[model samples]
Target: MQGKKFGTFAGVFTPSILTILGVIMYMRLGWVVGNAGLIGAIMIIVLAHVIAISTGLSVSSVATDKKIGAGGVYYILSRSMGIPIGGSIGIALYIGTALSIALYLIGFAESFNGYFGFGLTINDIRLTGTIALLTLTCLALISTSVAIKAQFFILAAIIISIVAIFFGNSNFQPETIQLFSSVDAVPLEVVFAIFFPAVTGFTAGIAMSGDLKDPKESIPKGTLLAIGTGLIIYIGVAVFLAFNVSSEVLRTDYNILMKIALFAPAVLAGIWGATLSSALGGILGGPRILQAMSIDNVTPKIFRKGRGKNNEPVNALFLVFVIAEAGILVGELDVIARVVSMFYLTAYGFINISYFLESWANPDFQPSFKIKSWIGLLGFMACFAVMFKLDMLAMLGAFAIIAGLYIWLQRKEVRLQSNDVWQSVWENVVNKGLKKIDANIDENLNWNPNIILFSGESKHQSYLLELGKTVSGRTGIVTNFKLILDKKNNKPLKKVDQIVRDDTFAELGIFARQVKVDNIYNGITNIATTYGFSGVEPNTIMMGWPKGLENSTEYSKMTETLLHLDYNLLYLDFDRKKKFGKYQTVDFWWRETDSKNAEMMLNIARFIIASPNWNKTKIRVLFVNNNNVNQEIISSKIRELVEDLRVLVDIEIINNAVEQKPFYTIIEEYSEKTDLTVVGIPNYKIEKQAEFVLKTNHLFETIGSTLLVKAANNFNVLDLDFIEIK
Candidate 1:
């Protein structure tokens, strides 16, 4: 089954014109002239239309380049600004359009009562509005084509109304023009609020974008035409009413259109047509917006259920009808108008902002029709300025509504893939930050770690990644390097292996990479020094403790190369088969009493505790008093250091092991129960090479996981020299 597609004239222009020549034009334009006069009303029309035109331009620019599906403004916005913003605007626009139905219905009911119900009560007006609402809604539900065809007759009636006004009014006296309402003489902002919706009706056509055969072409053409036509009509009405209608007649009698008409019945017909058409436009367009939003998962998908034979959004139409009837029952047309205006203005402001970002910042936003950045900026500023001036409470409420929707959608995390406007903004911000960092590269206090870790297969890779993340705290890039020795000639490692490794690391919230090289030693040396941007190169290299290092010289050569490059090297050894307990325990063994290892180990443990998995982990600052020299003094020293560093840890003095016992034996006996053990590797001279390797081998051979940390000159930790340990 194929859905009906509409062209520019029937799809865009007719609906747009009918909605534009709406209740505001017939009912409020004269009142606007009575208050703001010819010049003020013209200013209001021009200003409002400027926003509309700019938004139309922005819409056109974006629509032309992409195949706009459903969702209209929501679709365009979400696709351009990501789901959160788009969903927010979509919901606001939907409600605004839905409210418009009641707004128009009430206007029609008022005019109809004025013409026929000479002395009717408020109930009569509500009854009439309800009937009209149901009537138009039925027309809309029947099919969009039926509703659109009905707009043609409404269009004729509107033209006839305009003609009747021009021919019938003979009281032209430019000098007797009223500059303010004789009854109240309201503020300019209030008057602007009344007249602004006249131009906003163009979005009704925009909301029907999904049904349009060529939204890219139709939206720009039909929208601009409707805006231009509406502007002409409003300006003419302002001029006509200013020179002709008395200030008393304009202010006291809101139904000034019927009084000035050549045939009052034709004026009533025009009023009914305008209101009904506008109501129909809202009914037809509002549901489509909701349907599109639903399809995109911005709203409940149940709304996406009811597409009639003609592809009319049947479910969405019903939803819009219910809301509109509720508004009719309220019968507070003025308040609804202000709220509807506020939401439309807010939507326009975001549209302008989206365009401004696209034109000025986003390189991907290459539109066929170019819009100046200043135009979008001016539109954005004008919208909020007018909104706040018109009704600060309503403006704030509208923003609150949008904000609430934004937060809700963000929480939902609706995943839709598109190059959003924010991505460009973020990229520019990142570029600026990188440049600033590059310029301040020489400052030691400004240095942040950029770490590269040598990873093995999936099983061993996670350990290295976790430790790297612990040290880097995710602020710095932690790249997992897998160097595969090309033992089989021209037979590369399966790409799936690299993919699996990358995915596993990603699940742990880390980045990973695999490189096939002839040698792991040379690969590590080359990759570490040249892994990142100039100022952001890997300052630290992390790896799991190498197995059988006594049989290979790779570790010694790599350590020398790393030291020469001024990079801090850290190696971790952990029992992969072991499952850690709640409140993970970390044992930081202060072997050398040097600040380098003390700072590095403390920093790593600090980061680990920050993780949810290890948030309550207790740090044991174990002081091994092998010589049995002042155990109380050493415990006191560790306590002061822990307190000075502002870390919560228990100070333990290892008195069970004597100087004759191996350090590994002491570690195995004391720290085997803990989740992690941290020991600082002493800076080994060339003569103490065998001793250094032996110590590393013994530590790696321990039952618990161990981190062997060696800090460079760049690593900054708290100074213990100033603290007086009693």
Candidate 2:
């Protein structure tokens, strides 16, 4: 049962034709012709169809190129514009379609009230409309085929009525066609508003895109054919009304078709059938849109379920029925018609804009059916022009609703399968920028750190990424790399591991990779040197503190080699569990004047303080008492240095004796109150292995989380001349 699907005629043309030749044709076309005259009415039809046909061309071009699934216009727009804009417009279209059901039902009720209610109340008319809405909704729930088959009978009644009116006329008076209404000439824009909706039901077919067997082939053919057919019918009706009816009668009676028909009964039947068929079309199309949005997770997930053996969207159909019945209570057909028109026109405008942007900016948007970009632009402009003239406040309200929905959906972060068109747009922009940068690649005053961070294992490394992002400012590249020593396996990165690592890095919006090699040192050296673009190569290497002194020699060797290659090194020993207290302090230890690490540490702390998490972090400069050094002189020098640098920090003089206790204990005691500490690595010396081992162990045991730095002296020291006594 699920295998059966709708082809072009039953799925697309039938609904499109039924909706286009609906209540407006039988009930309102004569009124439009009466007010606007023959030429003005024709102009209105042509302008409305121009927007419809142009939008159809764009829809066709995109439909032919991709496998368009459910969501119809929503699918097309979302796939082209991304989920946020697409979802918002889809919601508006859904509401429009829902209201369309109500509009058709009220039209049916009004005609029913007029024909059968000589002595009945308006409430009775509402009951009949309610009954009709329920019957059609049940048919829609049972099968789309049921409602579609009902349209055949409706179509037959309409044809007989049209034949009676056109051929049954004895005389065609061409001179009776007035340029303006005999009573009062309605504005051309107002007439266009009333007439424009006639051309819009063509998209009702597109709403059933999910049920069609081949939407790509059916949507374009059936939609365009419907538009062309509606245009011809409207033109013929406008001409017939102009010549056959007196301008005074046309202006006075909106139901002039019934009064002039050879068989008044058949004409009455045509009005009822046209209204019912259009209601059927809405019932059939609106639910499918809700179902598609549900499937895409834009709507609630429960709506994704269907009850029928053929997977008909019965739940969504019920939802549409409830909304239509509510609309039946209001029961004002003309006002409902105008409100529905605003939503439809806005949707049409967005559809054209999506296609225009695709054609102009996205090189990947290759469609088999090509449409000129200007047609889309023109269609988009025309839709808004007519919309504002119809009702400015209503149009603004509709736009506000769509924009609000877009903001809400963006915050929800709904994910879809379509590729982001923004990526292609950005790619083109960046390509042009790169070409411009090639000519002046070596200009001075451009400094960005392309970093290669050594991630030993993938556990608890989120802070590493945070620091990388903090320093890079999202302008430079930071790659988290893991090196495996076993080289035998061809694909050393396990799928599960890659997925876990990717998910971790994706949260921080960073890049991560793993490389397997015979030696870890060789892997690090190779990747760091050859990782990034020329003139933007990896200028920095960052690593966490080593586990013990056992790997110090190898690490020192790596540092020397990296420094020789003009790369700066940063070593961090921070714990992820630490939280910032009310009084946040960053302790910086100055070892000597030659330690360029002083400048690098201060710069990094400044970056940290700029972040929201560490916004109030205070910096404190600390130094141990040296041989015969005066504490007052040192404290005064630190003050002078802080004043010169124009930064706020505390100057601490530590009096702990290094000979009495381990250097780690003294440093830890002095820095116990601080949140994070900054220390510099002493210059590498091959003759002092024991001393290096002792210092490495003691420093790693400092009170708080610490950062170890070894600057390559690639930058000048901060000016300290003011700190020197005059």
Candidate 3:
């Protein structure tokens, strides 16, 4: 494994071509021609090769584009597509390759018994296969290069056998050829599945990419040549069988080619050679895949161990032997063939997907042998369709197994030291979506709050970010900017962004950002005026409640600036001493003049209850009606609004005109035991912050944790879920 020994022909083409013209050609081609006539069989041949050639193109494109890591397809995919998906597919490819050994041996044993057995049965074939697996496993454990040397002789036998079969005499059968066969044979899809494994050997070379002198040049050249060579031989044999042999005989005899060849011994030698060579190829390839997976921590560490100076994967080879033995015990070539086909198809599909996404996502991916991304997509689609056609239940079960493995790998956090395409893909999607969206949205019909946080209190940053998430209700976004009051105005914006860009703040759709300013008041004003885009701009400014009357004047001025910009102001009066006790009750105080605030407050209340802590908490809408309105009438009006908003609330209407207790007094009596209370800031003159703060401070003293909301627009209360009041 450590030596630079193989050139293009020995490394890639010889092994690949040997496997492609293998067990299926000797044992199953006549059956396929019988089940589907000449035209139908040719269609199957062409269709299967389309996937192969497409996958080949994708493989070439990826291989030539970059310097893929060692470990063949596994390394290429893990580097290009990320590890979890790569490991999932890599494991499948290894199993497929290992199980294929059993399939070839089963064919060999059947052919051997037909030529020399004294009326032996399936049991005899199984015995022969076990012997063959042991012999091949020993050869592999001894020296892998011996297997490569053997393939040259195997290739010669296969060519001679093809020549013998072509010249062999068959019973006159000009009338046997038909466009389609009778329903007596198995379904067309079944025939296709049985024949599908023949084309899969095209990738046999890709698994040995690490051994190539220049994989970039050798891989594409050798792989494409093998596929082309296999295609010509396959279609030639299919047409010959259709025209020379009678359909009834073709249907009945699995080894009709070997029986009717010009020199039966030569054909038998070819059959033996093809089957053994393919098994040998699998033996040589499967362990390498497992070994790669082990070294990458995708599998256990023990399988990564090797023997001798060449570092042969002796442990992984034993595992392959075990799986191949189990496959042999299954004792049905068609069953084994179908399993092999499904596995190969699954891996091939993902390979194309990886290539397709990588080409589009990575702008630097310019391959000398570039193929259209549509070709890769086409390959993916064809594989998917063929898998379902082969066996619907089997296809679903295979996908489920692969998906389960992928999930397990993800949980293990299989980190590869490479970049994946997801970030670029997501950015492209977002950029396209943003460019396509209109700036002006119908506010009443479809809107969600985009909150901008400019809080002065650093200790409550996490709380404010979480609150933004809760209020957005998954339909909006949040941006938290920790305003660093740099009176010197010395910090650059690059470092400013770095200031608040902690990984923790970006959770739950919040964008963590920072800015430097001379004062909190001017910073909020300038940032709010400039932040965000036109369509999804920030319409709400969230800030912690002012701590003392010392800065009430500046806070009041900032509040006026936001109001003038037509933005809603939500001041969180979070009580650290009694932080949102039990989240049991939400009281939204309402009045006629505070109708707009009532809408925003109701939206916030709905968002609060959606949180896990408050999901079961009920909303209690408490209205203080001052116009001497009838209690029941006010209750019905508010009830209609809540019902239209599709939310549940207990309506409590108090006719303050009858017993006009102060607003703070009413809160002290009813909301003293509540977990959270919502109130609105009354409209006042810009210079009257001292008067406003004095009353608001007392209200907070009377209530528990509270949100003081002031809306700048008269938005409909019923459309709180959709509308944004900016």
Candidate 4:
């Protein structure tokens, strides 16, 4: 899927057409100083090229990495620093895309007004902008493949118009060589302003670098080519206008291309074509950044949800258009442009800073293309220089948005971490701690062997009957049988609760009692903790070892909690009914070394042997030999300790005659005949060995036929709260 998509993107967005026109228009210079006066038009062109090369170099240096994503330059910058910085850059990129959309719409409206006397009011302009936005939105709603194809057509029209404009006006040159002299008419400030717009499209090509075939080679070539083409077009137009047309005519209107189009038939078509092409470009690129940001969790997840048939982020594209229409309503093109520049500048400044910092910190962080560190330094300065051009209110508004987002993210991250930590701490302090208290009380007071049955609405209910007949003390069964009603779903909680109650009552007859709780797992833990704290610990906690689902985190955590509370767990491993009258072979696998929690497993094993089923089952203890002298000594001690049970059970210690992995050997030899295998819980540690044992499939897979026993320090059997049987 990934390979196919890349192929399509590569074919459509390679920098072939864009490079030719990127530097030509000098829109910025024209906008600032209509004709560039006659003095600095040449200088402005030269300076624009210099700026273009430097900016392209900066971008390419970062783009060389194969890991670059849709966020393009911004993603690279943020990842190099950290999430906080990356998140800030992400916001800037989104704003930049949005502002570009607005700029395109403004240009679109102006050009349409010039060509067709639509007599658009401020509201009418806004409506038209909205319409344009919706059109683009629909285009974007289609798959990415369709959008790229559309861009190809837009590029084609732009190239054709540009070619005609230049060819048609070629014959209209001035006579005198002196006519080619530098324009003194254009002001430096005006020239700079005009040159700014030309630079806008240079970065447009780089925006799709993530979607490019090879960003490193492609971005540099495409960016340079685009800027070069744009430069030539701008200079040619400026030169033609300076000699053939008067400065008075240029000053009257900022649309030099449209003005030229009036006299020369070819120029008019080119003017319209360029405007439409630029507008389409904005539409094609904007929603992609939004989709990328959404996937990264910097924005709402819905924006990153499944794409429509056209492979576009339909929801995001719709949103961009809606916002663009709002911008058109205001009809303040300068405001929109400045804001756009401000956002891009902020993002670019950070990118430069991040690169500089990363280079300083890591010696290995070199790119294929090297820009003198000074270029990035200059890039930083350039961004700040442009940023200051924005009005105080706009700057303040931008800052406020950034600050608000940062605060919200920080709070959310803190809350999530805190919740996880609190859960862990609470389970240890209450559940495990209370069980110890119950154990101490039970030791002092004479109490019958209490049996706690964990059952649900399943076939495992027969164990309850067997326990009822054998146990001579207080017996209680617990199950997670409740209907949770969501108010948003418009379901009555009382009705839902009644249904659950009726169903559970019907299943268990009069013997079983249902306990209603908010969350099943937490409820069970809470009840067990309460009972243990009250000094009433059950002798045996009878529950089925829910087969096929032991790998789940919830089950593991619950099992760990039970082990920690020192509950003698009765894990009924019955998958189907078998002859109950005959005794079956039971295999016990015990490790040599004893840890602090080892007693929990041993106690549970003893309780299982004491069960009614134990009388019908033959128990065999198989001890694997550990070579470590100290471990072997501990195993010997454990062996002597269990010798008292030899009268009632068969015990054997396997010696290491052949050296091999103990776990593998034990499972290979005894698993075939064993009805049930018993193993001890692992001691939790931060070391690699412990982690390997916990995560590896060897133990889990081998112990499939076995019931795992983990020892706990603070838990007592009396605290067992049975939650479910099925």
RMSD of each candidate?
Answer: 5.9, 7.1, 4.3, 22.6
Candidate 1 structure quality by residue, lDDT tens digits, 115-207: 675445678878998888888887777777888888888889889988998878645344577654445677777788777777887777888
Report clash pairs, candidate 3.
447-722
**Residue 182, model 3: Cα distance from true site in angstroms:** 1.6
Candidates' TM-scores?
0.76, 0.70, 0.88, 0.51
In each prediction, how many residue pairs overlap at the backbone (N, C-alpha, C within less than 3 A)? 0, 0, 1, 36
The Cα RMSD in angstroms, rounded to one decimal, for candidate 2 relative to the true structure is 7.1
Candidate 4 local lDDT, 1-726, one digit each (tens): 443233323432332344234323523334333445544577666654554556666676766643566656545654565445556666666666666666666666665765688756776667666777777667656555665676666666566656654444323333432232235455555456546555555556655645666666777666666666666766776666666545554555454554445344444444545555565565655666667667667678887754543345667677667666667677877766656655665666666655554444444457887767677667666656654553455656666666676677566451211121123334556666567866666343322444445555556555444533333223333322332324353433453334334443444332333455555565456555554325444544555545455345665566566656766554544424331323366666665443422344444445455665665677665666544234345445556555533324565656553565656556656754465656554554323333433433354344334455443334333211111211
Q: TM-score of the candidate numbered 1?
A: 0.76
TM-score for model 4?
0.51
Q: Judge candidate 3 at residue 591 and give its lDDT.
A: 68
Alpha carbon RMSD to native, model 4? 22.6
lDDT per residue as tens, model 2, 162-267:
8878865534354556766444677777777777778888888888887889888999998898888888988998888888886666667777787778888888
Native RMSD of candidate 3 (Å): 4.3
Candidate 3 residues 619-673, lDDT tens each? 8998876666667667776777777667789999776776888887888899987
